[model samples]
Target: MSTFQERYAASVMNTFGPPKLVLVKGEGAHVWDVDGNEYVDLLGGIAVNALGHGHPALVEAVSAQLQTLGHVSNFFTTPQQVELAEKLLELIGADAGGGKVFFTNSGTEANEAAFKLTRRTGRTHVVVAEQSFHGRTMGALALTSKEAYRAPFEPLPGDVTFVPFGDVDALAAAVTDRTAAILLEPIQGEAGVNVLPDGFLATARAIADEHGALLWLDEVQSGMGRTGEWFAHLPSGVTPDVVTVAKGLGGGFPIGACIALGPAGELLQPGNHGTTFGGNPVACAAALAVIRTIEEQDLLEHVSVLGQKLRDGLVADPRVTEVRGEGLLIGLDLAEERSAEVAAAALKSGFIINNATPQRIRLAPPLVLTDDDAKAFLAAWPAILDEAF
Candidate 1:
C-alpha cells in the first residue's frame, strides 16, 4: 500500500472498505492521483461535482465569501443565504406559491430535517418506495427501504411503509390519513438510476392530496440539472409539497436544503429543527456560484445533448443489456454480474465509474464534462467491457 493508503487505513474509519486512489489534484472533468496517473472522473464525486473539479466560479465564490464573512449563527442571516434560498425557490417554481427552506450540510441532514417537518403534521406514517435510499441518519434510514442499510439500525423512527416503486395502486393502498408524507426519488440514483414510470408522480400527487399527506421528492442526487432539468420531477408537472436538494447544488461544496412548498412550508415551527453550519455564508455563496455557472454555461442544455449521446453510445454494446436514467445520471446493466469488474476495468483504463449493483454500472460525470473526454470514454468503453467480461 502507498503511504497515504496506509495512513488512511490506520486513521480513517473503514466505512467505505478501502481507498481506490490517493487523488492529489483535479481540474475540469479530470483528476490526477498521487502517482501522477490521470483519469476522467466519470463518477463526479457521485453527482456532487456539477461544475467539475477546480471550477473557478465555485472556488472564487467560496473564497470570497470566507474572506468577507465566513460563519454566522442562525440567529442572523446573510445576503448569500437569503439569495440562495430565493434562487432555489425560483428554480423549483415555488417562489409565488409560498415556500420555506431549511439548509443543511449534506443530503442526509436535509432529509433528516424534512423527516422532522413531517412529524409536525401530527402524523408519523410515511410511505416510501422499494429500493429507495434516503440517507444513513436514523430518521432518513427509516424512510429508506433497503434492508441491508436498515437491518442493523432496527427500532428506527417507525411507520414508514415501502411500496413497490412506480406502482400507483400500491402507493394509494399504502398511504392513509395517518400518513404524514410520501417520499420518493424521481430517479433512484443509488439503486442504479431507476426512473419512475410515466404518470407515477401525478398519481402520487393525487394520492397525497386525497390523504392530506405531504409529497416529498428527494432530489439530493438527481436535482440541480443532473437530469437535464432543474429537478428530475419537473417534467411530470407534479408540484411536490417538499423537495430536498443537495449534491450538485454547491458544485463540489457541502450543502443541502429542505424546501417545503405551499402551506406545508409553515409546518415546522422554528425550534422544531435547526443546524449550526447549514446556511453559513460560504456554503451559500458556493451554491449560488454553482447555480450561476450552470445558467451561464448553459449546462442544462449541454447535459441533455451529451447525456443522450452517452446513453445511445452505451447501449450500442451488446454486453450492455439495458440503460437507464436521464441527462448525465446514467446507469447500464451488463449481460452478466460483472459491474465491479467493469468499474475496475474502467479505472484501469483511466476512467472512474461506479457499480451500483452486481449487474448495474452507474455514471454521473460532471455537468461540465467536455465532449472530448466523453468521446475518449466512449472509445474506451468497448475495451473496458471486453476486459471486464
Candidate 2:
C-alpha cells in the first residue's frame, strides 16, 4: 500500500470501507492525489463542494470570520449566524417573517433536529419512502428505508413507515391523522438520482394538508442550487411546512439548517434542541459566502446550462441506457451492471465519478465547473465506456 493509505487505515475508522484516493489538493473541479496525479472531480465531494476547492470567496469568508471571532457557544449568538438564517429563508422565499430555522453541523443533524421537531406535534408516526436516504444519524437513519443501513442499527426510533416512492396513492394510504410528518427527498440521491414523478411533490402537499401532517422535504442533497433552483420543490409550487437543507449550503464548510414554515415553526420550544457548533460565526460566514457567491457569479444559470449539456451528451451514448436528475445532481444507467468498472476506468483515466449502484453512475460536480472541463469529460466519455466494457 502507499504510505498515505497505510496511515489512513491505521488512523481512520472503516465505516466507509477503504479510501478511494489519497487526495492531497484540489482547485476548481479538479483534485490531485498525494502522488501528484490529477483527476477531474465529477463527484464534487459528493455534491458538497458548490464552489469547488480553493475557492477564494469560501477561503476569504472563513478566514475573515475566524479572524473576527473564532467560535461561539450555543448560549451565545452572532450576527453571521442570524444573517445566514435570514438568507436561507429569503432564498427559499419564506422570508416574510413566517419561517423559523434550526441550525446543525451537517445534513444528518439537520434531519435529526427535524425528526425531533416532528415528535413535538403530539404524534409519533412518520411516513417515508422506499430507497430514500435521509442520513446516517440515529434519528435520520430510522427514517431511511434501506434495509442494509437500517438492519445494522436496529430499533432506530420506530413508528416510521416506508411507502413506495413516487406512488401518491401508497403515500396517501400510509399517512393518517396520527402521523407526525411525511418526509421525502425531491430526488433520491443515494438511489442513483431517482427522479420523483411530475407533480409528486404537489400531490404530497395535498395529502399532508388532508392528513394534518407536516410536509417535510429533505433537500439535503438536492438543495442549495444543486438543481439549478433554490430548492427542488419550489418549481412544483408547494410550500413545505418543514425543509432540511445541507450538503452544498456551506460550500464544503459543513453547515445545515432545518427550516419550519407556518405553524410548524412553533413546534420546537426553547429547550427542544440545541447544538454547540451548529451556528458558529465561522460556519455561518462560510454559508453566507457560498450563497452570495452563487448569486454574484450567476452559478445557478451556469449550472442549468452545463447540466443540460452533460445529460444530453451522456445519454447520446448507446452504452448509457438512461439519464436522470436535474442540474448538477445527475445519474445514468449503464446498458449493463458495470457501473463499478466504469467508475474505476474513469478514475484510472483521470476522472472521479461515483458508482452509486451496480448499474448506476452518479455525478454531482461543482456548480462552478467550467464549460471546458465538462466538454473535456464529454469528449472522453466514449473511450471511458469502451475501456470499461
Candidate 3:
C-alpha cells in the first residue's frame, strides 16, 4: 500500500507542494512526526499556533463551547460571540465604544469584509504598498501587490494602485481625492518579514487623513502580541481606521476579524456584508482562551526577550548577512541563496524553520516557546548554515 505522503501527493492539489514530515502529535513548541521523531517547531505553523499545540486552555475552551453551542446562523448570536468581540476591542485599545467588528473564518474573509467596508465610502480607488499581501480572495487579491499571485486571476477588482513600501513620499503621491483607503501591512511578512521604516506608518496615516481616505492595516501576521505588542503598529502610535487580523487569533481553530474605528465602523450596514459561520461560539471561545492565556502568562514579555536572543544568536554567525524584525517575527539574510537547503538541514537537525525566499529565513515561533528549545536551535544554527552552504 502507498504511504500517507504518497497518498497526499496523489490526491491533494499542488498548491503547497510536497509535505516535509508527516506530523502526528504536538505539545507546546514541539511536534512529533509519524515515526515518533521529535522536532522543535520554530515556525509555529507560520505563526498561527500562538499558544502552541495541545494547550489545555485552548483544548478545554473549544471542548466546552462545542458541547454548549457549536454554531449558530448570523440570524442569531451567542454570548461567546459578543464577548469575544468586546475582548478583541479591548485588547486592540479601541474599546472606546465607536469600534465595530466583522468576524470571519479566515484572514482572507476578514480582508474581504474590510474590502467591502472600504467601498462603502463612496470611493473606489485605493492605494496599496508594493510587496504587501492582504489575502488570496479576489477582493483582497486586487489589493495585493504580487503579480505572480494576482496574474492567474486577472480582471481583478480594479481602482487599486501600488506604491513603494516604506516610502512616505510615494504613499503621499499615490493617494488622491478618489482614494477610498490606504491599505498596508505593519511588517510585510510574506515578503520575508520586511519591517517598515521608522515613521513610515505615521506618514501613511497623515496621507490618508489629508486625502480623506481610510488607513487600513493588515495585521494578519503581526497582530495578537506576535511583536510583543497587541499590534505591530502600536509602536507607530497611529490608530488606523481599519485593522485586519487573524493567524494567531484563535491559536489553531480558525477565526478572523476586521475592526473599524470611529465613523469607519458604521460604514458596513446590515445589507452590506454577512457570513454564515463568521462568529460561531466555539471559534470565539477558542480565541478568547488564546487571548486570555497570553495575558495570564505574560507571553508578550517573554517573546520580546526570547526573540532578541534568537535574533542576536542567528546573526552572530558570519554566514548570516543580516537580521531584521521585532519580537518573535524574525527574518534573516543568508550569505548564499540556499534557504531551502537550510530548511532541510534544520529539519534533519530536529527543528522546523521556514524559507520565505531564496536567501531569507523567517522565524515566527510560538509566544510560549521555551528557553531550552530556543537555545537548542541557536546551537544548531551554525551547523545548519554550514551544511546548507
Candidate 4:
C-alpha cells in the first residue's frame, strides 16, 4: 500500500515540499503521528493553534455553534458574529469607539480586505517594509517585501515601495502624498520572527500621520496575545489606523479580521467588500471561545512567565547565538546554519518546531504549553543540538 507521504506527493501541490510526519491526533501541546509516536508541538500549527489541540472550550464552542447555526451568508448577520467582533474590539482596547471589523476566513483574506480599505483613501501607493510578509493573495502579496515571493508574481497590484524595516528614516522617505498606507508586521513571523527596532512602530505612526497615510499593521502572526499582549503594537502605545489579524484568532479554527479605527473605519462602505464564509457563526463562535478561554484562564500572564523561562533556557545553550522576541513568539539564531537539521533532530526526539530560515528557529507553541513540556525540551536542548551538529 502506498504510504501517506507517497499519496500526498502524488495529489497535493509541491508548495510546502514533503510532509514532515503524518500527524494523526493531538491533545493540548502533544501530538501523535500515524506511527503512534508522541511529540510536543512547539510550533502550534505555525502559530495558528493558540489553544493547542482539542481544547474543551474551543471544541465545545465549535460543536455547539455548528449544531445551532453553522453558517449565515453576508446578506445576514448572527449574534456570534457581532459578539465576536465586539469582544475583539474590547480586547484590543478599541472600545472607546470608531472601530469596525471585517471578517475573513484566513489571514490573506483579512489583508485583502484591509488592502481594499486602504485603496479607498484615494491613494494607490503603499509603503511596505523589506523582509516583511503579508500573505500570498495578490493584494497582500503586493505589500509583501520578499523578492522571492513577489518576483514571480510581479505586476502585482503596483505602487508599493519597500523600505528597510525598523529604519525610521527609510520609512519617512518612502511615504508621500500618494501613499495610502504604511504596512508593517509587529513582528515579521515568516522572516524568522524579526522584531522591529526600538521606537520604530511609533515612528511609522508619526510618519503616516504626517503624510496622511494610514498606519496599517499586519498583526496576522503577532496578535491575539502571542506577545503576552492583546497586540504587539500595544506596548508601543501607537494606535494603527488598520490592524489585520489571524493565525491565532480562532485557535486553529481558521478566522481573520481587519479592524479599522477612527475615520479609517468608515472607508470601507457596504458595497466595498464582502465574504461568504468570513464571519460565519461557527468561525465566530470558535474565535469567541478562544478569546474567552484566554481571558478566563489568564493565559497571557502564564505565557509571559513561561516564555521568559523558555527563552532563558534556549539562550543558555552555547549552540544558540541570539534570542529575540517577546512572550511565546520567539526566534533564535543557531551557531550554524543547520536549522533544518536541528528541526529534524528535534522531531526525532519527540518535538515539533519550525526552521523559518536556514539559521533561525522559531518557537510559537500553544499558550497552553505546560511547564513540564517546556522543561523537557530544555533538558533535551543540548542533546538536540549535539545531534544536529
**What are the per-model C-alpha RMSD values against the true structure?**
0.7, 0.8, 1.1, 1.1
Deviation in Å, model 4, residue 196 alpha carbon? 1.2
User: Which ranges of candidate 3 are over 4 A from the true structure?
Assistant: none
Error of 1 at 258 (Å): 0.3
Report lDDT (Cα) of residue 33, candidate 1: 100
Indicate which candidate wins on lDDT: 1
Between prediction 2 and prediction 4, the one with superior TM-score is 2
lDDT tens per residue, model 2, 1-389:
79888888999998887788888899999999989999999999999999999999999999998999978798899999999888888888885888999999999999999999999989999999999999998999999998999898897899999999999889999999999999999998999999999999889999998999999999999999999998988889889999999999999998999999988889899888999899899999999999999999998889889999999999999999999999999999999999999999999889999999999999999999999999999999999999999
Clashing pairs in 1: none
Q: Give the per-residue lDDT digits (tens) of candidate 1, residues 60-101.
A: 998888888999889999999999999999999885758999
| Tens digit per residue, CA lDDT, model 3, 308-385 | 999999999998899999999999998889999999999999999999999999999999999999999999888898
TM-score of 1: 0.99
Q: Is candidate 1 or candidate 2 better by lDDT?
A: 1
Candidate 4 has a TM-score of 0.98
Q: Please identify which of the two predictions, 1 or 3, would achieve the higher lDDT against the true structure.
A: 1
Q: What's the lDDT for residue 377 in model 2?
A: 95
Superposed Cα deviation of residue 292, candidate 2 (Å): 0.4
Model 2 misplaced regions, further than 4 Å: none
Every model's TM-score: 0.99, 0.99, 0.98, 0.98
